[model samples]
Target: MKYKVTQETELLNFLLEATSKKRNDLKKALKFNQVLVNGKSESYHAFLLHAGDEVELGKKSRQDLPFPILYEDKEIIVINKPSGLVSEQTMHNKSETAFMIVNGYLKKKKEKAYLVHRLDQDTSGVMMFVKNKKLYEELTHNWNDYVLERSYQAIVEGTIKKDGRIENYLSENKMQKVYVSNKKGKKAITNYHVLKNVKGYTLLDVFIETGRKNQIRVHMSSLGHPIAGDRKYGAQTNPIRRLALHANIFAFEHPFTHKTMTFKTEMPETFYKVTGKIKK
Candidate 1:
């Protein structure tokens, strides 16, 4: 269901007057992130609503998803992808994937989804897909030009005393593992700053200049501080029982509209649990 706001009011009050559902039900919807304003999820009931705003009560999709939809429109859809799911199906692996889940949801609406980019199977956070072929081609052809920022949050196994940069060439073996190689390999660069150090863990804010496969994982491992639980890169501990890396921020310009778009998700609670810091 959708509503066009005619007057300024608090979101909860506006919903109360606009919908036939009880207050408790509306509150529950807000809590579960079933409400969206102008295509973005708004969980705060006290958020101010103004005239000319588009309010949507998102009904549950037929397909069950482990992740949450952050934003969607006729042109594109963004999701906060959870860990342990492949971004898309592979030649050998035809099992469930993020693409399959989003495609299923769109199929229910008589729409189609196109792959834009990918995240590592163990990496969690913002991912996007285009709804049409034109947009897909535009983005995939000029990805670096349209993408303004890509950042991540990670909990590495050791303490990093200062901000640093890592630059090296990376190559992948037949086994699908990526390693640093200077012999005809792709150059990758990553910059990181220490966010906090708790116990034996170090939380880092990471940015990448070139999106090579496994760039961050290889770079951090070179510094002797592999991401927690990333055994593939020499991590000694599994404090979180999952890769402690997350792609938390993605900012880009819409290929068709040229409008700035940004999506972000909070670091998983398990990250804070291992770091002994509370998320605020």
Candidate 2:
């Protein structure tokens, strides 16, 4: 809906009268960039509106999104990325990446997206991207400092009797497979909590202190309980038909604003099915 301001007033006051929406709902709309003033998004409730200003409600929805957008703002965009799509383009494969899909979405607004981090091709759920170069550089350069939480949910092949932590050095080989290396490699630390065990499979809530290439997969494999469907990590089962690892929760501090931001996505229903648990 679009409204032309006939008198000077505050944005929230104008919205309350014009849209007849609850104040909290209108606040949420503004926070999510659903309100625009003369084409630019405005999130401030107290922003002054003058006569002749055009206010628009409702952001344009993208059609056929491979990954569902969880949140977006002027600085960053978050998505619940689906499995099977690579996070970003690589030299060998340049088509149909999450980055490409999001970039296309932003292009309509005359903006661009920059990759802040990546989730593996088969990993589904929360992924974030920066909108501009300055914020992108700020985030990438000090990622460890800004990132507060990185959590995943996985269904592994065996029944874990207890929760534990795995600490080791990991190195990737020429074939792009990660393995524990005692001699020389980057340190990787993973902590796992046993969520449940169903049949022969175990559901794990995995947290990583150090993000390395395939850290969770390697750590779980080291425990002799590789994530289900993770064939490369020595899993004997492919229950979900895809890697049973999902980056379900991600929280970080906004580099520029210094405010904590969090994004979460529901675990895939297939994960629950594989574990014989009802999705809630």
Candidate 3:
């Protein structure tokens, strides 16, 4: 929706009054970089809108991009982020994050994207982001309802005898290292099914019910099968020379449209090379 201002007003106030949306919703729209002024992406809610200025709401047009666009619509965008890229910048990592890359691509088109979830820096996988605040609020507030299934593919050390599920309480210490705790913590659950045993390593299809920090890494390590190359979780092997974790599948319904959407990615080639042979 586009609005041409006939009188001077602040961007946010004008949006709230014009659209009849709650203040909080309008704030989220602005914070997520959804608002546009005069064909440029604007973040400041307090941005002054002069007479005759143009304002746009809802989905913005996306231009050609340098990176692969796995899927994109007016409501959401899914990107296949490469390994070694942080999902978002942190105090330790200030540059070259996937969020920046996506937003940068959109910025050229005077649009913006906002992340709904994250992937570890060393994990390559499909990631999702929302384009507008209403969708963002609906998805974030009722996350589990929208996300029907999420699965990961990983190469873990040692051979597993059979499929299993790991259920335990996980908590992080002051150093941010996640560990299984009996006395206290949030419940973490991981279900794993062995896909193939190559050489001494096993390829497993992993699924987690809860999105805890390092849930997969910690659960696998507790079973004496830490993902290869995850030094933080006590793996001695670096078979793939990177964390052998990849988010390979997501099945969900659109929050607003309620349309079923499923996405999947093949395991990284490195996961196959170190295992001696790739499974057909």
Best by TM-score: 1
What is the full ranking by lDDT, best candidate first? 1, 2, 3
So what's the TM-score on candidate 2? Answer: 0.76
Q: What residue runs in model 3 are displaced by over 4 Å at the alpha carbon?
A: 1-67, 276-280
Clashes of each: 0, 0, 0
Q: Give all candidates' CA lDDT scores.
A: 0.86, 0.85, 0.80
Write candidate 3's Cα lDDT for 8-118 as tens digits. 998888998789778977765654345778886554566778999999876433534423467887667787666666899887789667788788877776768888888
Model 1 weakest lDDT span, ten residues long: 58-67
Model 1 agreement with the true structure over 1-280: per-residue lDDT tens digits: 9999999998889999999989988976764457888887665677778999999985553345545888898989999876777889888678678899899989999999999888988888899998999889988999999998899999998789999998889999998899999859998989998888889889999999889888899899998999998999999998766799999999999977889999999877557677776444
* Model 2: CA > 4 A from native: 1-64, 278-280
Better of 1 and 2 by lDDT: 1
Worst 10 residues of 3 by lDDT: 59-68
**TM per candidate:** 0.76, 0.76, 0.75
